[model samples]
Structure formats: structure tokens, C-alpha cells
Target: MNGGPRLFSILRQGPYLIASIHTALDDSQLVRFQQDLVERIGSDRARGVVIDVAALDVLDSFASRTLRDIGEMARLRGAVTVIVGIQPDVAFAMVELGMDTGRVVTALDLEEGLAELDTYAAAPPAPRR
Candidate 1:
């Protein structure tokens, strides 16, 4: 397997990786996406990730959970994951479904998401306990 998704792409932009989902993806593809994303973050030494799902019309519970998991995994790699471009309808549906994003940050668009990454990058690291 190429460890890549056909329905979406993970493009590198400096210290961030942008996962742009232009269309819906099946469960298997989502898994591949999760794996590929984490791997790329390490291989590319990315400081952050932005998952853009604006083009998606529907975001189901499983997909939402998978996204949350990806965010958590990325964080473990010392990278911040921000999800952007969630459509209004899909955002409502996620709220109605009671889906939570956990520690993942969200923004309205790519520019905002990148700004979030910049802010996080500029912030000092959490002091060790």
C-alpha cells in the first residue's frame, strides 16, 4: 500500500502538513490517512497539521472519532493538529451527534488554521512536571 489516500491529499507547507479531504473517504481510507499522517509528521518533522474537511458534506461518528484519534496521535509526536474547513451543516450534525474533538484545535479556514499553528509554535513549551 502507498499509505496514502486517494480521496484526499496530505501536502507539506513548511513546518505543517495539510490534509485536504476533497471528497468523502471510506473507513479503510481513513485508517490509511491516519497512518500516513502520523508517519509524514515524523518523516517531515512537521510542527503542526491542518486537516481541511470543508469539501465534505457528511461527517459521521466513526469518521469524527477517527479524526480525534489522529489529533491525539499527532500530538504524541510533538505536533499540534488543527481541523479546519468543517462545513456548517456538518458542524451542526457533529454537534447533534455529540461528537467531541478532544484536544484538537479547530479553525474556520486554512488561513486561520495556519495562524493557529503559528501561535502554537510561538508559545513556549509546557514545563515538565
Candidate 2:
């Protein structure tokens, strides 16, 4: 995580913590990526995460599961995880593989995903007495 163009970039915009995944995510790198994310979230308490997957082309079962796990883990840490840039064919194939992406918010592109995260960030926090 210290070099190699950064598997993911952690950006802090106001109250939102965005993690943009710029490299090709695979089984070999997914675990390290997740560990990095966990550390970031633990430190920042980010309200939302935007995973930019535009650079990825082929996603196997392990990658898909990693994504799903990322989403769930982010949620457990109180951050919303949104996956962006998933191509149509890849999405279709993921569905065929029964990858439960239902928990992960998805966007066609980074801009849209960031916008969605903005909305989530802007929403009023739950009432706390």
C-alpha cells in the first residue's frame, strides 16, 4: 500500500471519505486493499466511500466477492460503499455468477458515484437525543 501507484486513493471531502480504486482489483490485491480500507475507515470514520472501478476489465468470482465484502465491511464501519464504473457486460456476468451486489450501491461512472455520495453526505444525520 506504500507504493505501486496506490491501489486506492483515500480522499477526504468535508465529512465524506472517498476511496477511489484506480488499479485492476484481483484476488492477489483485494485483501490488501480491504485491509487498507479498514485502516482508513477506522481512522477517519468516513461517512461514505466511492470505489472507482473504471480501470478494471475482468472480474472473477474472488474479485466480485471481495467487492461485496468491502461493501459490507464499510457498512459495519458506518460508511456507505458505492461501486462505480462497472461495465454492462461485467454487471450481467456478475448477476449470472450470483454475486450479491445488492448491498453495494452502483454507479455507471465516477462522477455519478461521487454525486451520490454527496447526497448521502448531505442528508441530515439521524436524530440524536
The numbered model that scores best in TM-score is 1
Runs of candidate 1 exceeding 4 Å displacement: 1-5
lDDT of model 1, residue 108: 99
- By lDDT, the best candidate is 1
Q: What is the TM-score of each candidate against the true structure?
A: 0.94, 0.81
> How much lDDT does candidate 2 score?
0.78
lDDT of 1 by residue, 2-117 (tens): 56546888999999999998788889988988999999999999999999999899998889999999999998899999999998999898899898787899999999999999
Q: Please, what are the lDDT tens digits per residue for candidate 2 over residues 13-126?
A: 665666666777667678888888777877887878887777777677888788889889888888888888887777788788877576788988878888888887779876
The lDDT of model 1 is 0.92
Candidate 2's C-alpha runs over 4 A off are 1-3, 124-129
How does candidate 2 fare on TM-score?
A: 0.81
lDDT of each: 0.92, 0.78
**Lowest lDDT 10-mer window, candidate 1?**
1-10
